[model samples]
Target chain A: MNRFIILLLIICSVLPVFAADFWLTQILSRSIILGVMALSLTFLTAYLGVVSFAQVTLAGIAGYTIAYFSANTAGIGAELPWVFAVLLALFFSTIAGALVGLIARQSVGIYSIMITLAISMAFFYFTRQNYSVFNGWTGFSGISAPSVMGLDLGAPVVFYYVCLFTGALATLFVVKFSSSPLGLSIQGVRDAARRVRAIGIPTSPVIVSAYAFSGLIAGMAGILNVWHQERVSSFSVGLGPTIDVLIISVIGGMRHPLGAFIGAITYVMIDTFAIDLISRDRFNTVIGLVLLLIVIAAPEGILGILKSVKERIKKIVLN
Target chain B: MKFFFIVFFNGLTLAALYFIAACGFTLIFGLMRTVNMAHGALLLLGAYVGYEVVEITGLWTVGIIAGGLTSAIVGAAIQAYILGRYQGDELRQTLITIAISIIMADLMLWAWGGLTYQISLPEMLLGGVRLPILNVGYSSVRLTLMAMAAVTGILLWLLIAKTKLGIIIRAGVDDREMLQALGFETKKIFVIVFAIGGMLTGMAGVITGSALSIAPGTDMQFLLSSLVVVIVGGMGSIGGAALGALLIGMAEQYGLAYAPTYGVVFTFVIMIAVLAIRPQGLLGRSEK
Candidate 1:
């Protein structure tokens, strides 16, 4: 297993360089960003039983903030340095995350899902119409990427590494959180809110914190997402992206943290290749059908299927 | 006063339209405790049927009936065959239904491209009638639609409150175990309820399609509306759905009327406010 882990890491590191000739770099980076978003969702859903439908919206808010801040204030020649702009974007995104958490954490079950969807839709439409700030539908272009101590930050390969590093950090944080006492408390709250309350556990704080954490992760993904697109539009964070995140989380197996990474890869690959194979018009049909099949077969997602199969094989071998 | 009347009447009309769409959604939700994400997809299906009818016969009434009936049949079949088997599993049911919705939406996209198609009402039903204070005029078709909705509501109310079948349904919602103890096939009841809900959503689609315009993303938009209605109305309450629909309808029209720019924001604000204030809904009965 240790060797396999090293081999897997080696493969991931070298594969991007090999596929750099094609659009695989973009694909991998997207998968990573999407993976980060999916990881946040999986953490919230699995531990808290909160299937927030606003992960993409949070991402969009982060992206739009970055774009807006990075907009050339000084007549295209100078601006409030890339670092400040990025910080401003991150701060705004955190606030957006907190706001979403506060509002969405009020209700439970499907009602909460609807509330998140509504809020996200409102944000999407608001940004789409408010041209003065978000530049309306045309969106803000020429938003430069972040550089570390004056390194050329505009390269796709550099951006990919940035995504990789953040994605890895996000994944590690989620795993650490999941095994902690806090994670257990969250699962406890989800499993039996009444019982937990009876035992003097404050349920609301856990849920709110989960939402905030999820938002922070989503915001980070959003920053990376804007950097990837280099042009943020309302279309970037609408129902389409929202649904894609849901599909990735569910398909990857919401049971485990690693499932997000797996689901992100499959969803991005399938969505991208499906679009490449056919036109954009028929993409949803194919994606939807795939979603249906995956749900029917593996309700726990791809990870669930893999685990179940592995267990079955072990049982057979022992017999 | 006349302008007020116009907004009020328009709001009611919109509410009536919303109620027609939400009835099926709330009914199924009542029994299943599952939000059928595909209800919107089903609405799109009915709209397509309407479109096909208009293309085939060029008669508005026939198209409406054909579209509604097709939606009902499809709804019934899917519920009876697929959802019926997944009784008592809310989470799995949600997953499956979402999948079904996606598949249906895709199928609709394949069958009818992304272009928007409008079905014209008959010449007789095209214009509005005048009243004293306000021109209270609208497509006669909408009037017919209101009448049909009223009839459906009355019948559904009777079925839920008056008939033996309705008693079984109520019992099923209150306690499936006791109902099953009495040897009633709750699964069959669920299937019937789901079918009826589908039929209602289909009818709504046909009416809405005729009233406005049916397009590819119509289902998603309707689904969002239905979710708002159900959440605002109370998940399992029929009356709640009607009241919720009316509120949303009024809010939407008035919001759009008052500030055309913030029209979309209005419904969302209401949803957030309602959920925050009364998580259950105005008329919703609390479940233990």
Candidate 2:
């Protein structure tokens, strides 16, 4: 797994040298950002045994924070330093996620789905309805990427590398944290909450911490996403994007964090190239069918399918 | 004082609509354990079909029947064919239904376009009526809707309490394996529950189409409302659904009227508060 990530990083690092500007900005950067967001859902689902529809809501909270604090086309912008804006965004989003976790701490499976779904939709409606802070439905525009240190993130290649590095760091954090004592406890909670409680370790804090960590990851992606679009709106956190994250996580294989990137790249590929096979208007139909097929045929997603194929090939060769 | 009466009546109308849409959702969840995430799409499909039928036949009653039947068949087919394949795995079933909803929403948008459709009201249902005591004018359709919701609640109650299907459902809710051991066709029972739920959703769709308007995004709106209602009350309990609907519907209308901007927040607060206080909901039975 380590070797595979190293190889993947090597390829990604060199992509800007060979790939077109369009590919760097639109395809790769976008995929990395979406992958990071889906990683949040993947982490919770895999570790906490909780499926959160509010992951994007957490992301949007950060995105909106950046929009409100940073310079904006809308007059409502506070025009804070980009660094401050990003920090505050992360802080607010993490809190929002923790709050969601607290409310839904006792729930799991279908019940968890309901609560998170409602919370996500409520945020969407709130953003659309509350004009003073969110600028109503128009949201904020003309928000450009900021220079970090000496690097101009406005450059296409720079932004691509930025997203790639963010994704890599996020992946490493998950990999490292899962082995930590707290992470093991979170996993234990997933396996059997009643047993964990029987051991006298309070389960709610672990669950809330997991959500907060994912919130931080999602918030990072959300900021990158806002930079990617150069705008944030109600559409960002709406049901469309909420479902998009779920589709990515499920498509990538819900259990693995790295699968999120694979899912995102595949999803973004379909999003961009499906127009070649069908009308642009029917894209949802195509994607929907893809998701439906994945759930029914390969619940384990692309990674699972690859594993099975490898096993079958090995069996045939041995025979 | 007069304005208060209008909002109160408005709240009733909204409650009635929510109750009609949610009872079916709770019914399916109560029996199948599947959340039917595509339920909103089903409701939207019913509204579109009803709109088309009313336009073609020029009969409101036919439109209602046609819409309800279409949703019933489709809902039943979804359960009997697709969802039934993943019995006991609630997560997979929910995921599959979400996919279905996405496909259904896109296809409906293609077929119905993005236009806001309002099923025209019949001649007798038109105009306003004076309410007693308050003597304030209110829409007759809303009154009819309230009456219809009450009737629906009673009919559903009877269906659950009186019919053989009800007995199977009650039995299934308490113990599915036992029901199967008793020689019941569990899959058939599931299909029946989905059909009834779909019918309620369809008829509610038509009613909502006439009362307000139906558009592409209405599905998500109603779906979220149903989720909140079912959560706020109790899952799988009819009385809970009604109570939840009343609370959420009244909260929604009152919020919109009193606090123009933070109305969503008000409804959101109620859900959070209820979840915090009673995770099982107001009338929901706590699970072991």
Candidate 3:
């Protein structure tokens, strides 16, 4: 199963080079960028047992920041470096994320969920109404994509490779972080908060820091998302977007970071094709039903089932 | 002064409805330790049933009763078959309930076509009288809701505080294994508790629908409000849920009347303040 996934990944990574329209390539690129955002969620939820509903809002904050800076009117000057704008936006999002995390850090269990949900809702409404800067519900348009090192990165295929490379780098970072002592401690905190606290691990700071880190990644993805679509709106930070991320993480099983990408691909596939097959209004119904079946039949997700099958085959051979 | 009084009265009315809905959610969470995300969906299910009943039979009381009964039956069956199977594992139970919620919500959307449906209340109950403080048109049905919910709250308090069944439930919440060892059927207790919780939610639904009408996103809105109530009330405390609902209701009402645009912000501010002061909730049991 691992080999098969890897092979598929390789094929997908290399396919655009052979043949593809810019539009189709853009879709794939957007999915990867979304995958990055989902990957950030994977870190907090899968690794840390904190099912934060605020990551998308963090992304929204960052995306709007980027758009505000890059907007032709009353935004950052065209002469001002785009890199500076992206960094500033990311910093803003990280701070916003930290503030939200601080507010939410005190509560555990369902309270945490409510706190995050409230914050997300507030951000969504604030953005939807704040027309002076955010351009209100209509959102900002015509923000030019960044041009780094004289490369026209706006090209779909070029952007796809960029997303692919960045995704690989982020995945590596996540894997390393997961294997580190800090990551193990996060997991420890999740499993037994009292035990971890009793041992003097100072779990709260660790979790809060993870939230910051996760926010940074999500913010970066948000910047990329704005670049990909050249648009940012209130809907990007709403409940639907949050649920989409959750579906990706949960469907892929929150156990591993790779699950994010796997889940993202499956989600994009389902979302892109499933609606066409059925009444468009029933899309949520289909997705919801799929999620129900997954929860019922494969609580550990696809990875767990494959692992079990692999174990069974090995046991049989050994016997 | 009159305007303030009107806002206060409106807030109280909203709070009464919120308390009715949150009562069941808090009870189930308190007993089962399960975060039934589907509770809001179940409420919607009840509203839809009531909508159908009122549309067909044109009897408002019958509709409300039928709605509550339907929710109770469905809640019992799900608890027995799905939630009961995963006793003690809160996370798995939550996931199962969330799945159920998702399916139920989708099915509701499919059935109801995202249209707002109003219950056919009797004219006497639908109209209102002007109070001296304000010329308010309050629904007589909402009055019934307020009265019914208050009575239900008292009955529940008596059940849990003054009866053997309540004793067993309280004891079981503290130590399920001990309750089991004491020859009590904890599973049966869970089913009964879950069904009652569902019935309460159903009652809240029909009442709210009768007051405000039923719509597609109504479940989500009510769920958000119930969550706020549960948080402020602290998990598993019936009185706490009521207090939270009252506070939120009043806060939301004042917010809508005064700020208008910042109603969501008002609820959130209270939530943040509560979370900062008491993370365990105003009424939640101590967590070490």
Better of 1 and 3 by DockQ: 1
Q: After superposition, how far is residue B14 of candidate 2 from its true place, in Å?
A: 0.4
In order of the candidates, what TM-score does chain B achieve? 0.93, 0.98, 0.96
Off by over 4 Å in 3: A1-10, A22-27, A72-81, A141-144, A179-181, A195-201, A316-319, B133-142
The C-alpha RMSD in Å for every predicted model, in order, reads 2.6, 1.0, 2.8
Ranking of all predicted structures according to DockQ, beginning with the best and ending with the worst: 2, 1, 3
**How high is the DockQ of candidate 1?**
0.58
lDDT of 2 by residue, B52-163 (tens): 9999999999999998999999999999999998999999999999999999999999998999999998889999888888987888899999999999999999999999
Assess each model's interface with DockQ, reporting 2 decimals per model: 0.58, 0.89, 0.49
Q: Which of the numbered candidates is closest to the native, going by highest TM-score?
A: 2
Judging by DockQ against the true structure, name the best candidate: 2
For model 3, which pairs clash? none
- Provide interface RMSD per model, one decimal: 1.9, 0.7, 2.1
Per-residue accuracy of model 2 over A213-262 as CA lDDT, tens digit each: 88998999999999999999999999999999999999999767888999
C-alpha lDDT of residue A87 in model 3 = 91
Go through the candidates in order and give each one's C-alpha lDDT: 0.78, 0.93, 0.80
Chain B of candidate 3 achieves a TM-score of 0.96
